[model samples]
Target: MVRRGVLGYVLVLVGGLVVSVLPASSAVASLPLVADLRSSTGGRMLGLAVVVVGLGLASSAWLRLVRAAGDLGVREDDRTALVHRATAAWTLPLLLAPPLFSRDGWSYAAQGVLTHLGLSPYVWTPSILDGQVVEAVDPMWLATATPYGPLPLVWGSAAAGLTTDPWLLVVAHRLLALVGLALLAWAVPRLSRWSRVDPARASALVLASPLVLAHGVGGVHNDLLMAGLAAVALVVAARHGWLVGALVVGLGVAVKLPAGVAGVGVVLVTLPAAARVSARATRATQVGAVSLLTVVCIGAVSHLGVGWVHALGVPGEVQTPLSVSTQLGRLAHLLTGADLVDAFRTAGSVLLVVVAVTVGLRSRSGDRRTALRATAAVALALVVLSPVVHHWYVLWCLPFLAAVELPARGWQALLHASWLGGLVAPLDSSLRGADAVIAVGVAVVAATALVQAVGHRRAEIRAEVRAGAQARTGDASPTSPISR
Candidate 1:
């Protein structure tokens, strides 16, 4: 197991090193050697090849780590410790590497600088800033105001104060993401125990997932922080009470609004198992009040007002294929030659609210496990039905889902999703304008790796099923000579 982890770590590190050389829109211009390499087509192709191979290797390694985590002979505490150590080791390579998979880190740095200059990120675009910071920002977001809450702005402002270098500032943001990762490490196991799932298995699923590593950590996304805090909130609420949970989730909301959904779980878990409708409503109201109060206090303290609430629609401006509503809208437009994107998006939003309310109402009288599942369901609904869906958005519910027991097929689906999500950015980044031969080769390799991984998991599942059936038959057989 240790050897497998070491191998995985080495593969990811090698891939990360190659990725570090690829010219990102937000990359710092200080590395002359890397710059020279990136300026040449051959160098770029070599880097792409290395990156593709690295991703395949890393994906395989992650699969092995997850599989090893499920060994029943391993004690739960030992499994948890193994996952934690492996996660820490795996994170080391990407810790200092340039932001992987996305340019949002650049935006965070620029926004932080804006905040430090007493400019409101909620109102001011990163374009307002001058120098390397603004240069590193993606053009699409250059003029777009950030819809993120004030807490992140404040966090960014603190990092900006420490370093004027854009790369360093982005690294600072990565450190913030690390804090979130720490919270997940601490919270996932407790939540898993509450749900009667294996702590190590759940920890491996969330903390060591390729999706979390590539996007949550490598991308330096604030979603990591939000998800971590939300997970902690659910666990805290389940153990301590709803008030503490409300406060924790409120802090999460201040990082990203979607995290506010966890507040429902907090409320539901605190209600009596046979609570009346009025009682449920009252508890929800109380939790909502505390959460709202927390957000209001954060905004006031940060001096960045709650204007972000109005700008929540900012992300919807971009269309992503992952968004069910966006694709449906596009399909409608294609068929009817009419623009119905907004209508579809509005309908999706309405449906999400209805689902959240229905789930909350039905789960309010259930156990903590049910509340946790309900929260996960609402989060999944939010991502699926939102106007814009980024791959990392799934992180919002990943911890909760990991804490719950899932069937073999469900785990298989998650594994596939994680593998694909981890590959999306590297493939997209490396293949654009690349030599056709190289692109095709890389795609074939990735597809083959995925197929093999899936096939291996299916085989393992079949073996486990057969073993279970044999064990059941053995238990049912008589030990008497007559029966023999």
Candidate 2:
């Protein structure tokens, strides 16, 4: 455990260092202090190589420590929890350091400010800001607002009403993330208990995860808020044996449209039963009741009750490489000399829905918790594979992955590493003129290393499962315990 803690901290410390030095974003008020630093360096290139290398090394070390400690006995569980918490402590500062941490967040704030001014957000775009009172408009918005769900717009606009300072919005967004963090503190232990996973083990895994800490806590991504609601819904559905799982999912939708990814699973879980017949019936009933609740709630919050649908159409302009449509856009630019990232994203999202539905219905081959986890994994994979994968999308799977009885340790490691790397991905984009290099070298390279961690865990879990099965069958002598 001591070794694991030392190794993990060393790595995380390195990663944090890398994160800290990366260039600030466009939103930061350019202070002469940085110019002084640049002048000291003779305006030469900053320690780009060192920053990237440090984060890389730290990320790898942290990944290894998580795997090594996960393999320990009862003591390993306690150690894992401790190390995870320590790692999570890095979240706040890391987020505070980045310039691009709140690109979309600012858009939400803009909409909020606009709404407070008696203007319908559905009709407002970032382009309208030239004559409007506002914080620094996120140049990243190009000419439009978001393509995200409307609930966030409403809430963000409300928050925006509270301040005209871009810096203040950043602070507000972070504070909002604390609510999601509190929810995690409350739910993770319970979710772990439901899975029969050690509460401490579960807490360490979910509570301390780099993804949950960075994306959910630091970046103030709305995904966390909706994720908390979805988790709450999951727990409530199981506890009450209610057939309104759809409503829980709907609340998530109230936050963001992407949440419907998990909502679909909730519907399956809440199908109603005929005379307490099969689990399907009860789950179905839950779906119906939840769906009704979702519609009513959305209507109450939206401009025209259906205006969000229209606002969704407005975000069709921003071309982003983080999304899958990046590839298609490149192809279009090559062939027709046209930029189509947003259009491609829309089409890609459509196909993703199809794939998600197919997987949810087909993977219908596991236990209750298993089914839920599998559904979440599919959703996450789809999000990752989708064009323009904002880092926070990872928040969708962090909790579910932690709660599930996964088949291998490699899987767990993959989730962790990918999560950590994701938090750092946008840091590159914040760097002027160096984004391409940083994104590819540090961010992408780190992600690949994290994938290896996943492989290690997957291989490890398979061996453990097989050994247990053999022992249960009385087919082998129990001469030794497995070690990784």
Which candidate number has the best lDDT?
Answer: 1
* After superposition, candidate 1 runs with Cα above 4 Å error: 1-33, 364-366, 428-445, 458-484
Model 2: worst 10 consecutive residues (lDDT sum): 38-47
Clashes of each: 0, 32
Model 2 root mean square deviation, Cα atoms: 6.5
Q: Estimate each model's TM-score.
A: 0.90, 0.70
Whole-model Cα lDDT per candidate? 0.77, 0.55
Q: Which residue pairs overlap in candidate 1's backbone?
A: none
RMSD of each: 4.7, 6.5
Tell how far residue 104 is off in model 2, in angstroms: 2.4
| Candidate 1 accuracy as TM-score | 0.90
Model 1 clashing-pair count: 0
Summarize candidate 2's per-residue lDDT along 377-406 as a digit string, tens digits: 766666666665666676776666666655
* lDDT tens digits by residue: candidate 1, 107-135: 88889998998888888888767777777
